[model samples]
Target: MTTDSLDLFADQPPTPPAPPDDAGAEAGDDGTLALDRYAERAYLAYAMSVVKSRALPQVEDGLKPVQRRILYAMSEMRLSSSAKHVKSARVVGDVIGKYHPHGDSSVYDAMVRVAQDFSLRYPLVDGQGNFGSRDGDSAAAMRYTECRLTPIAELLLAEIDRGTVDFIPNYDGAFEEPQLMPARLPFVLLNGASGIAVGMATEIPPHNMREVAEATCHLIRHPDAGLDDILAMLPAPDFPGGGQLISSPEAIRDAYASGRGSLRLRARWRIEELARAQWRVIVEELPHGV
Candidate 1:
C-alpha cells in the first residue's frame, strides 16, 4: 500500500470505550477481588509516610522535621540567647507559616513540650506565662503564653547551628533541617523519650542532667564498663518535676540494663495555707508528660 493510504488508516480514531454502569463495581464471592489492590498500596504508602515523615527519626537527622524546624526557627528568631523573649503565639505562627506547614496545634504542642520543665530535664526553651505547672495542668492559650530559648537550649542549639551540624532540606525542600542536635549533654538520656510506631515503641525515663553527665563522663573514662557500672553511677530517674520513680530496685536495674520499660511517675506537691482562710497547693515537681 502507498504511504498516504497507510497513514490514513493509522490516523483513524478508535471508538471510545463504554463507561462502567455503576460507580461501585461487582465484588467477588469472597469480597476480596472488589478490594482495590491500589487502595492497599495507597494505605501502606500513607502509613509509611506517617512513620517516615512523622513517627520515626531519619538517620540523617536525629530529630524529626518538626523538631528541626522548631530549633531552626528559634535560631532565626534570635530567641536563643541575648534576645528578648517572644510570644509563644509568635513562635508558633512563625513555625507554622514558615517551616512545619502542619496544623498550628501540632506546632504549638511541640513548642510546649520543648518549653515545659517537666517534659525535658533540661528544658530547651525558657518559657514564661502559664506554660502550665508540674501538676498536670494545660498551659495557657497560645495568645496568653510567652517563651524564649533557655541558656541550655542556646548551648545545645545555637552553638551547633554555627556550622557545627549538617543541615538538609525539609520535606518540601523549602526549609533546612539539622543533622543532629549538637547537644553538649546527652539530651536523649537526660530528657528521655516515649513514642509509638507501627510495630514498635519506646519509653524512657528522665535522668538528672548533672548525674547523667557524670555517668557519661564515667563511661568515657571506662569504655569497657558494664551496664551495672553505669547504673551504679546513674541510678533512677531524677525527674525535673521531682516526682519519685516508682520502679522497684530490680525493675530499675532491668530498665537500665535493657534501656526500656514503663516508668511510673508522680507529681511532687506541697500545700500551704494562704491568708484569709485560703489554701495554696504548689507542685514542686512532676513526671514526664504530666
Candidate 2:
C-alpha cells in the first residue's frame, strides 16, 4: 500500500518552483528589501509625482505643468496676441505630441480653463469660440474652437527665451520645457490656485491687482511689518467674479496667518425695483468656485 501511494504521488506534478527572487534581491544578495519597505518607496514616488508634476502650481509662476505646457506649445506656434487664432485642436495636438504626452482632452480642458474669464482673474488665452460658461456648461470640442495667447499670457512667456527660468526635459525627453513662467507680475497671488495633491491641497482666492501691487510694495518697504500691515493694504481677497465676503477682517487675517481657514462668500446681488411694491434681486456675481 505504501509503494502504490508513493508511485501515485510521483506522477503528480513536482511542487511548483519557488517564486523567483526579486530583481534587487537576485542582483545583490545583501540588497534584499522587505515588502513593506518596497511599498513605502513606491507610494512615496507616486505622491511626489502627483504633488510636483500634476497638482500643485509652482508658487513663482502660478501655473500647473499642463497649463504651462499648453501655453509653451502655443507660443512655439507663434500664437501670440497679434497672430491669428488657430484651431484649438492644432494646439492640443502640438502639446500632446511635443511635451505633455497625455490624452488630448486633458490638454484641451486645461487650455479652456486658462481662457475662461470668469475663472482666471486675468485669462491667459484668447479663445474665439464657445470656451464655456459660468453656468457650468462644457466648452465646445477642440476641433470647433480656436485660440491664441492673450496679452497677459505674453507677459509670462516674455523672457522665457532669454532663460529667466530653468528648463527641464519633457516627458519623453525629446524636447525641453520651462520649469515655470517668467512672469512679470506675481501671477501666483494674482490668479490664485486650487489643487488637490497626494497629501496637501491649496485654495487661494484671487485678489485685486491694485491692492496686490500696493501690498507687495508695502512689503518691499517694510520687510519687518506684521500681517496687519499687509492686511491694511490688501484687506481681503477680491475675486474676479465679484462676491461679498461675509468673513470678518479678523477672521481673514487669521486665515492668512494659519494657512488654513474658509472664507464665507455670498453672492453679490442688486435690487431692481420694477415698481414701488415689486422688486427683483439681480445677482451680479457668484462666489468663487460656485
| TM-score top scorer | 2
lDDT of 2 by residue, 1-290 (tens): 00011111011222233333353653345766676756666665656666677777888888998899999999999999999999999999999998977778779888999999899999999999999998899999999999999998988999799868899998778999998889877888888887766666777878888898898888889899998888888898877788889998888888888877878998988899896699999998898778
| Span of ten consecutive residues with least summed lDDT in model 1 | 1-10
Give the poorly placed runs of model 1, Cα more than 4 Å off: 1-49, 56-64, 134-136, 264-290
lDDT of 2 at 78: 96
Per-residue CA lDDT of model 1 for 60-84, tens digit only, reads: 3335557667877888888865688
Give each model's clash number. 2, 0
Candidate 1 — what's its lDDT?
A: 0.67
Residue 80 local lDDT, model 1: 63
Using Cα atoms with residue i matched to residue i, what is each candidate's TM-score against the true structure?
0.71, 0.86
Q: List the residue pairs that clash in candidate 1.
A: 241-285, 241-286
